[model samples]
Target chain A: MPNLYDLAYDLEKGLRESAEFQGLKQAYDAVMADEAAKQMFDNFRQTQIVLQQKQMQGEEITEEEIEQARKTVELVQQHPQISKLMEQEQHLNTVINDVSRIITKPLEELYSENS
Target chain B: MPNLYDLAYDLEKGLRESAEFQGLKQAYDAVMADEAAKQMFDNFRQTQIVLQQKQMQGEEITEEEIEQARKTVELVQQHPQISKLMEQEQHLNTVINDVSRIITKPLEELYSENS
Candidate 1:
């Protein structure tokens, strides 16, 4: 029978491989669900709607009106609520990084010992 | 000026010492706040309350009633919700343990390299 250390080593190797595959899947899902990207797309759609609404109202698109719309888009992009959410996302990323560091400690030790 | 490794080492040492102190404080607080112990004490108090309530009602306490009350106390002590909470606590402990292991990897590497 294989010793406990050998069995543990094999299990660790399998876990690392599975975790890598899972990480890739998670990254793909995150990109697909990115709130910031969705918000920006929504802002663009809203601009189109605003222009359409103005046309229906028989309002001539003036340079000043166009400039105002541009500013509104910028404001939407830089919304305080979005900024706060981004900050929270960054904080969560930090926590996840810390947790990842903790999980990888034993592997690093094993590498160092073997080397 | 200290090298990056030296600075990192000093920072790690300080963090470890602070974390150790925090862990000790948390353990002390956990012992003091033990819900199971509190529940057992409450059960004893409830028994006294029932005895008083019976005397006020002019009802004689029988051995069977006392035995039934003891079983109720046992059932309260063995509440499923408390067991579920304990399981959740154990799961959280596992996560914390995993995180701690990851965080300590670099230190273990350094130790192995120095040795």
Candidate 2:
């Protein structure tokens, strides 16, 4: 019997392929209206490609393998704007750290002198 | 001047932190009801963590860097189910290839014999 992933994979592949083929005739409409929806669909398609490639290459599939694959894909799909946000957050965090360091410098010197 | 990623990062971080803090007070409700939406949010958060960590570690940020980061995050978020689908598609493709190989074997043999 096939597992949940196998079943889900087949279903999603069929939907995507059908959508693509329909696109050739201009019969396909947007199934997902938002960026997040689009991102999720794309991510799912990519994961399918990766799995298919691995199988074609004769990579062994194990039952014990964790399905973090879904979570990983999901995480990125759910947060379409994450990368940009991350870059900004990083810059802000750096500035915050620098300011903290600067503010603490005088206190550090005063403590040392008193000691 | 800050770039797109930097601005996007700050906005997302603010939103997430506000959401989290509101969560502590039970004032936060579901901003995204679907799995895909949740996945996109998670992916964005993870990317933010990675970028923030890199910056904290003093990794250099370059202006020339392509924002495939967003695309990657978006791809995974949008297609939250892609991984499982890929696994199934891979299995199906493998079976299809094997069947094709078997079917072609007799034709190849017949051709060889005729030659």
Candidate 3:
């Protein structure tokens, strides 16, 4: 009789050990090593979060704001190291998403029944 | 600059430390301590996986199979410890889902733009 938490711990350990996550960590370290790039990324991330929060709250984002966001994304994507890190992030998130999907299947079933 | 992976690790640590997860672990341990309950839970889980897989593959589940699955759910719910564990699982998963949603906010924005 294995406790589910033991299995949960194993899953966490597996994710931490996965190559995708390791690559993400490496990219993150690279970004941290460069001050200019780090600042740029942080700024972009803050703006992104603010915009997302606005969207989530049903607040209307102006056309100017949308264009500004697009420009910030363009700038962020132009930085080689930062762009690479973003790519690695996308890859890592895909892995996490797969793991989450599998672990939450039971919850999905339960909720679907309720819905 | 704080690396994204460091933040990701923090999120994992937070989840592991959350009361919901701890409660789930406790309930899981309780179920595991009872041999008969553990066996029953395993059997139900196996059936659940098979049925889910079949549904995912677009195979029609017979009425009998549906009834069989319902019966198993009812039986599992009747077991106090197992029912409690299931409830804990639901709560823990809700916490995990919220964390995942927050972590993947940037990805959502990226994808929404592409779409």
Interface RMSD of each: 22.8, 22.3, 12.1
**In CAPRI terms, where does candidate 3 land?**
incorrect
Per-residue lDDT value at B63 in model 2:
48
Expressed as tens digits, the lDDT of each residue in B25-69 for candidate 1 is: 343334335676546535555786888788665578899878978
Residue B71 in model 1: shift from native, Å? 70
Q: Using TM-score, rank the candidates from best to worst.
A: 3, 1, 2
| Leading candidate by lDDT | 3
Two-way lDDT contest, 2 vs 3, winner: 3
DockQ for every prediction shown: 0.01, 0.02, 0.04
| lDDT computed for candidate 3 | 0.71
Number of the candidate with higher TM-score, 2 or 3: 3
Model 3 achieves a DockQ score of: 0.04
Instruction: Enumerate residue pairs that collide in model 3.
Output: none
Q: Which residue pairs overlap in candidate 1's backbone?
A: A101-B102, A101-B103, A102-B101, A102-B102, A102-B103, A103-B102, A105-B105
What tier of docking accuracy does candidate 1 attain? Answer: incorrect
| lDDT, candidate 3, at B54 | 84
Chain A TM-score from candidate 1: 0.37
TM-score of chain B of each: 0.36, 0.33, 0.91
